[model samples]
Target: MRSKTAKLISWTTGGFLLVLAAFRAPAEVTYFLLSTRLVGSALGSCVLPLTKPEDIAEARREMTLDQPPLIPLVRITAGADGINRDYLAPGKPSWTWHVTGFVGFVEGVPEILESTPALVERRQGGWFHDSSGAATVAFTGYKPVAELTREQIFFASAQLTANGMDLHWVDLGANYLYTVETSSSFSPANWMPAPGGSWPIAGTNWVDIATPLSGPRFYRVKAELKSP
Candidate 1:
């Protein structure tokens, strides 16, 4: 009888060990599956778009232009009174603006030096003009203050006149690439050699006489100063 009890006990112990082993197999498999899934998720999230050789070539071509990236830097800030405006970003105060679009239709008076025509009289900032054709107009104010003054201070100032053709505006579709202007258009003149610095009068650095909305316009300080 004792021998029979021992055999039964051994049988029960063996059964419990087998059941535990069976349950452990699935636990091990579940752990492996979870680890593999996490790895896959990490890899998928880390992938980035591959840069092809063609993309590099295109970037190089865009960089070869004479002016700043013509797409993003175009901006014009005009005041409600039509004066106290600014064309250039704070980072580039010396750059002027260019006007394109309907070159033939847009007409305006020949830019007068220090005349401060009624349109921009006493205005010491920036302005913009749209063209009537497919092109857009842009303008800049290149005023470099020679000095600054306080209660009883004085400064020297200069004028940059855009004296060429009269700018006329008409609604027309004539898409054309923006062509830079000549250097003579933005040459500083009438330099007042004085003892202080103050804001000067307004002048036509660049102007685009287009319809209400022509398109994107480009502005710069030395667009015409590019190498041939």
Candidate 2:
């Protein structure tokens, strides 16, 4: 009957190309060994062995140190679904990069971000200390002409002399809200620096302003002072 209807239409197009190659999934190689020293200096090393997964996006290792060696600051391609969303699938395997430093009570991985202490008073510099002491003050009457979406708001509004302090102990302390993406073009594929440009206040003045919308956005106010 016409060669059995052309072999049942070529076995239904070879079972739809074997179910689209079994739903194509492969790509998961994670490794991040970024060494850093100076918290007491001396005791930072890197080893080599079994490294081949396309050479980890162009690997380069070195760390002999009296000073110098904390390379490979970029390879980030996480999986199991998270962080930069798995680079691009294809039979994943191969990852190793160790960064070490923690003498006296060694605990690993549990610091998304932690560094608190912010206090800087200036309208005339009458109490300065911001190099991690934290303090960059400047606020001008509610300036958000428009566009203010809210994923978390409360940028800043300071007035704490510290002596008797009370506002529930200055709202408990530790603040972070960053936002900087001034129209884009700072390179390294935009490594933060363009939200009116000028950054170094990182003790918490609420800086966590991620953007993707469009047009006009400016923010400023950093006051990270706590330690009572």
TM-score of 1: 0.12
Clashes of each: 28, 14
**Worst lDDT window (10 residues) for model 2?**
1-10
Residue-level lDDT tens digits of model 2 in 1-228: 010000000011322211000111122332333223333222222211113454433322222224332223211111111111111123221122111211111122223211111111011133222343222222111011111111111112212232311111012122322222222331223333434335433332322234223332222222233323
Local distance difference test scores for all models: 0.19, 0.22
TM-score of each: 0.12, 0.15
State the lDDT of candidate 1 residue by residue for 1-228, as single tens digits. 010000000011322211000001111110000001122231111000113344333334433544332121112222231111121223212212221111111113234321111223233342333342122222112111111111101111112124321221110111211121211111352222111212111222223232112222211111111222
Among all candidates shown, the one with the greatest TM-score: 2
Cα miss at 77, model 1 (Å)? 2.5
